[model samples]
Target: MQTTLRRPVALSGIGLHTGRPARVTISPAAAELGIWFHRTDVKAADPYIAARWDGVEQVPLCTRLVNEDGVSVSTVEHLMAALAGCGVHNAMIEVTGPEIPILDGSAAAFAQAILGAGVRRLDTPVRALRVCRPVEVAGPGGALARIEPAEGLSIAFEIDFADAAIGRQRLSLDMGNGAFVRELCDSRTFCRAADIDRMRAAGLALGGTLDNAVVVEGDRVLSPGGLRHSDEPVRHKMLDALGDLALAGAPLLGAYTGRRAGHALTNGLLRALFATPGAVEWVECDAECQRRLPGMGVRLADLAAVA
Candidate 1:
């Protein structure tokens, strides 16, 4: 069955890159509406933007969606992941600024709030994109993202950083049965201390602070409290990938593997998947198939594992 939030949920914080304060409200939409963003601040141009692969505009450091009218929203990965991982099939997201607030640098808050507000099952059956063949995309520095056939959504990610604090780390998960909420939602975005100055010089990460993100200098973690997980950086990467994959416009039944891949590479993989003939097919999910999807069995109790 399709699902939507039972009631509206609202959040407010500062954008990680724009550094502007914004408020976002997630409201339920009719079945098949999918996810959409309405920029309340835009008065002259079109305020609506569909959250889909073709709408994506490749940009450094974040996932952004631009509509035909050039209206855009940035850094939407976490919130998107929360909605997808919570089995939300349709929603209307209203934002007061260009970028989604980087709340605690993780999707935990969003997931918790959604679960608390409750998910209502719709009359329509759910549809999912099933990968029929492997589709891969490669980027500079040997980065790669691929999706292949799988019984359910799964992710395997590997990341290597020269910083001793976040060297090489890899993890693979089935992603079903509340795994995202329990294992990945609380993992915060991380960065190397040395790169912070460069990002600031480029006018990015302006709202970043030790409180919202994990900052590492050499072997030390500069954040007030330590990491939620030892391999938090890699886990956060997987979280981002899940959010990016949600842009496929439906739940995906496939295995995703990322090798040092970032936002652009993931979005490229989606484009490749759809553009390649016989790479994917949409099918109405059966009862058994729906049970294997991410967030199918998620409940409010799942919040106990999140932080």
Candidate 2:
């Protein structure tokens, strides 16, 4: 069955790129309404932006959504991932700024909040996009994103960085049975220490600090505390892939492999998947199929083990 939050939950923090304080409230919605964002600060025109792959606007360093009226909300992946992992099928995210708050730079906080608020099942059966054929997107700099047929949702990711501390990490996981809450939620986003200055010059990561993201300078970690996982970088990549894939507007029953891919490439893969004929089909999940989907049988106690 589809699910929605039992009650509205709110979080506030500084935006990573905009350097402005923002507040976001995740509210319940009816089944099939899908995930959406409404910019509360925009009073002149339509402030609504659908959290779907087709609404994505290619930008540097984050996942952004823009409506037909040119209203936009940036840095949505973490929140989106939390919604997907918590088995939330419909929500209305109300934000007070141009970007979602960069709370801890991971989905842990979001997941914890949603789980605490509780998930309520709707009467309708859950639906998922099942990959019928292979769909691949090649990004610049040898980045690649691909999806193939799979019985359940799975993600495998590889990332190689010049920084020795984060060089060549790889991992894969079947994202069922609350695996996302246990494995990937706490993995914070990371970047090369050397790139910080360049990014600041390019007007990005303005609100970034050691508290939110892990910073690596060659073999050394500059963040105040060490990593939550030994291969934190790769796990974070997998978390990102899950978030981007959530934009499909429904859970996906497919195996996703990302080779040094990011937001743009993942969105490209979705576009390619929808454009190709007979490449994908929507199916209403049955009892057995629901068991194979992520978040099936998930419990609030799942948060007790997460860090």
Candidate 3:
């Protein structure tokens, strides 16, 4: 069966790119309602932006969705990942500003809130996108994003950076059984010190500070508290991928492999998956398949106590 949050939950913070304060609320919706964002400040026109892949507007720093009326919301990946991982099928996310809060720079807060609010099943069932064939997209380097037919959500990501603290890292996981909360939830978003400066000069990162993003300079980490994990950067990338995949508008039954891939490459893979005929199909999951889905038998106590 599909699920929705037991009640509305709110998170307030500043946007990573805009640096503006915003309040975002995740509220329960009826089954099949999908996910949407309403710009609460824009009361004159239609402000609803669909949370589907087709609505995505590519921005270098984050996942953004735009509506027909030109209203948009940025930095939605962390929140989306929380919804997918927590098995939330329907919601209406409302934001008062242009970006979602960069709270602790990870999805942990969002997941913990949803679990505390809890989920209740609706009478309807969930529909998932089933991979029918292998599809892939490659970037300038050997970087690639590929997906193949699989029984449930699985991801394998590998990253290599020149910085000694984050030179090479790899992680693979079968997303079932609350693995997301245990492994990827605490990993924070990271960037090189030079990149931050460049972004700042280009009118970006206005809302970024040492607290919301991990800054790496050569072999040293500039973030005050340091990393939550040894290979925090790569784990965060995998977490981002899960959020990007959630935009498919439904759960995906497949194996995702990302090599030095980021938001663009992952979105490209989704475009390719949908455009290529016979590449994917919508399937109604049976009890056996449902059992294998992520967080199938997860309990609320599984979330880590991090504050």
Candidate 4:
């Protein structure tokens, strides 16, 4: 069965790059609506942006979606991961600003909020994008992403950096058994300290601070309290890939492998998957497939320790 929120869930915080305060409400939508965002602050023309790969307009530091009228919603990946990981099939998300809140730089807060607000099943059946063949996209160096047919949604991620503290890390996990909630929810976005100046020069990263993101310097972690996981950077990358892939407009039943990939590469992978004929097909998921999704058997307290 498909699902949506029983009641609207609200979240408020500062946008990571825009540095603007914003509030967002995620309300239940009728079955088949998928996830869409409305810019409540935009008083003119169209104020909505469908949260899909086709709606994506930018992928520099985060995923940004723009409507036909050129109105945009920025930094939507974390909230997206929260919705997808929670098995939310339909939602009406309204934000009072241009960007969604950064929220501890992870999807944990959003996950906790949704679990608290609760979910209700809809009468409509759940739909998922099932990969039918191997699809891949590549970038300079070794950055790449690939998807292949699989029985369940799984992620294989590998990241390497010159920093000794984050040299090389790899993780592969089947998303069943609340693994997303228990394992990947709290890994925060990270950046190299050397990039801060360049980002500021480009008039970005205005809201980044030591409190919300992990800042790394050479081989040392500049973020206070260090990492929640020894391989947190790579885990965060996987979390991002899941979020970006959620733009497929439904749950995906496939195996995703990301090798040193970021937002752009992940988005490209989705484009390639959809552009290639017979690469993907929509399937009405059976109970068995549904049971193996990211949030199958998830509990609010699954990540209580991390929370």
Candidate 5:
């Protein structure tokens, strides 16, 4: 069965790149609506932007969705991940600004809210994208993203950084059975100290603070209280991958592998997946198949074990 929020939930914070304050509300929608964004502030232009891969506009650091009227919303990956991770199939996200909040630089707050608000099962059967064969995309600097046949959605990620505090890290996880809530939800986004100035020079990361994102400098972790997990960077990468993959607009039963891939590469991989014929097929999930999908058995109590 498909699911939607039992009630509306609202969150507020500053945007990571825009550095502007915004308030967002996640409201339940009818079955098959999938996920969409409405810019409440836009009065003259079309404010509705489909949260689909085709609407994605390649941007640095985060995923941005632009509608046909040029209306857009940015930094949507975390919220999207929370929705997908919580088994939310239909939602209308209302935002007052051009970006989603960067709350805690992870999906924990979003997941907690959705779980607390409760998920209501819809009458319609859930449909999923089943990867039939290997489809891959490569970006500059050797970044790679690939998807292949799998019984359930799983992620394998590897990241390497020059900063000693975050050198090489790798992790793989089967995202079914609330594993996302247990293992990946609390991992915060991270970056090296050396990149801060560069990002600011590009007019980005303006709202970034030590409280929201994990900051590392050489061998030291500048973010207070350190990481939530030993391999938090890689875990966060998986989290982002899940969110980007969610743009498929359906539950995906496939194994995703990322090697130094970011938002753009993942979106590219989706574009490639849909463009390549015979690479994927749409199938209505059976009872057993639904059981294997992410968020199938998620419960509010799952939050107790998360950071």
Candidate 6:
């Protein structure tokens, strides 16, 4: 069955790139509404922004959604992942600023809050986008992303960094059995310390600090709390992929593979998936298929493993 938040859940924090403070609330919506963002600050014009792949702005360093009216919401990947991971199919995310908060640099907090608020199953059944054939996209720096047929949502990601602290890491997981909540939710976004000044000079990462991101300097990790996992950088890449894929506007029953891919490449993959003929088909998921999809068997207790 499709689901929505049982009640409203709220959070407040600073935007990762914009550095602006905002309060966001995820409230229940009618079945089939999908996920959307409403800018509470923009009251005069249309403030609604669809949280779909076509709405993506293809920006670097974050996932952004812009409506036809030019009102945009930035850095929405984590919150989107939380909603999709927790099995909330329909929601209205109301934010008081141009970007959603980058709380903890991971979806653990969002997952915890959503689970605490509970999920209400709707009368309608879930409709998932099943990949019929493989579709791939290439990005600058040799990044590649592709999705192919699979029984459930499976993710395999590989990342390589010149920094010794994050040389190379890879992970593959079947996103079932509460795997998202337990394994990937706590992995935080990371960056190289040498690029911090350059990024800041280029007007990015203004709100970034040691607390929210894992900073690596060659062989050293500069973050205060260290890492939540050994291969945290790669895990976070997978987490970001999940969030980006959520913009498909439905659960994807397929295997996603990302090779050194970021938000742009993932969005490109989605664009390719939809544009190619015979690449995907929407089907009303059966009971067994629904059970195998991400979030189906998730429980609030699974958050205990986030950290």
Index of the highest-lDDT prediction:
1
Looking at model 2, report the run of 10 residues with the lowest lDDT sum.
Answer: 298-307
The residue-level lDDT of candidate 4 at 41 comes to: 85
Clashing pairs in 4: none
lDDT of 2 by residue, 69-166 (tens): 99999999998888888889999999999999998989999999999999999999999999999999998889999999999999999988888898
**Candidate 6 stretches greater than 4 Å from native:** none
lDDT of 1: 0.95
Q: lDDT, candidate 6, residue 142? A: 86
Instruction: Assess candidate 4 and give its lDDT.
Output: 0.90
By how many angstroms RMSD does model 3 differ from the true structure?
1.1
**Backbone clashes in model 1, listed as residue pairs:** none
Candidate 3 lDDT trough over 10 residues, lowest sum? 298-307
Q: Which ten residues in a row have the lowest lDDT in candidate 4?
A: 294-303
Residue-by-residue lDDT tens digits, candidate 4, 1-307: 9999889999999999999999999999999999999999888779989999988885579999999999999999999988888878889999999999998998999999888888788998888889999999998888989999998899999998888878899999888778888889899999889899899788788888988999888789999999999999998998998899999998888999999898888999999999999999999988988898878667788878787
Per-residue lDDT, model 1, residue 225, is 82
N/CA/C clash count, model 3: 0
| Per-residue C-alpha lDDT of model 1 across residues 117-172, encoded as one tens digit per residue | 99999999999999999999998999999999998999999999988899999999
What stretches of model 1 exceed 4 Å from their correct place? Answer: none
Work out the TM-score per prediction: 0.99, 0.99, 0.97, 0.98, 0.99, 0.98
Model 5 misplacement above 4 A: none
Candidate 3 lDDT tens digits, 73-142: 8999999998888888899998998899998899988998888888888899889999999999999779
User: What is the Å distance of residue 188 in model 2 from its true position?
Assistant: 0.4
lDDT (10s digit) by residue, model 6, range 54-80: 999977799999999989999999888
